[model samples]
Target: MSERQRYAVLNLPAVPEVSAIKIVFNRRSAIIITFTTPEKEHIQG
Candidate 1:
């Protein structure tokens, strides 16, 4: 039997615009990434 190596890859798709990016630490102290897009503004208003 032969052993083969496995790998995992993560990629972010192209974004037209990244208005804002925020990094926060929650109660658990885990890093969280937040993205604010143009679409969000229309919904918020």
Candidate 2:
């Protein structure tokens, strides 16, 4: 999937609007989430 779509799937609003995200993993489970702001309009981080 495209990076934008990938991020969108996770509720992220473009990488530029993102400050940071955390990855949580334990044994066989993992997830990524971050706070997003729509201040930027860039496609690439």
Candidate 3:
């Protein structure tokens, strides 16, 4: 299976529309998601 397929299995977007998503797994077994907006797009945080 490819990386894209792994994301699909988790029901996550492989390519986000407006921003980029960063997935982090901490030592505490917690999932952290970070959204980073591009300079070209206007995203309301």
Candidate 4:
């Protein structure tokens, strides 16, 4: 197995009314990434 890289976490309460969240990753350089709650999961039969 291979090792995974680490990431930083940030929280924002500007828009508390909404049920959305954002995540940012600072790797190699400064970059921003966004993600929402109740993430998707895959199932295989």
TM-score of each: 0.44, 0.31, 0.44, 0.25
Q: Tens digit of lDDT per residue, candidate 2, span 1-45?
A: 478865665674455656655444456644444344466443232
Assess candidate 1 and give its lDDT: 0.49
Q: List the residue pairs that clash in candidate 4.
A: none
Alpha-carbon error at 36 in model 4, in Å? 4.7
lDDT of 2 at 3: 83
| Best candidate according to lDDT | 3
Ranking by lDDT: 3, 2, 1, 4
Clash number by candidate, in order? 0, 0, 0, 0
Give Cα distance to truth, residue 15, candidate 2, Å. Answer: 0.5
Q: Once superposed on the true structure, which residue ranges of model 2 sit more than 4 Å away at CA?
A: 1-14, 36-45
TM-score of 2: 0.31
Instruction: Report the Cα lDDT for residue 30, model 3.
Output: 60
lDDT of each: 0.49, 0.51, 0.59, 0.39
Q: Compute the lDDT for candidate 2.
A: 0.51
**What is the alpha-carbon RMSD of candidate 4 to the true structure?**
10.9
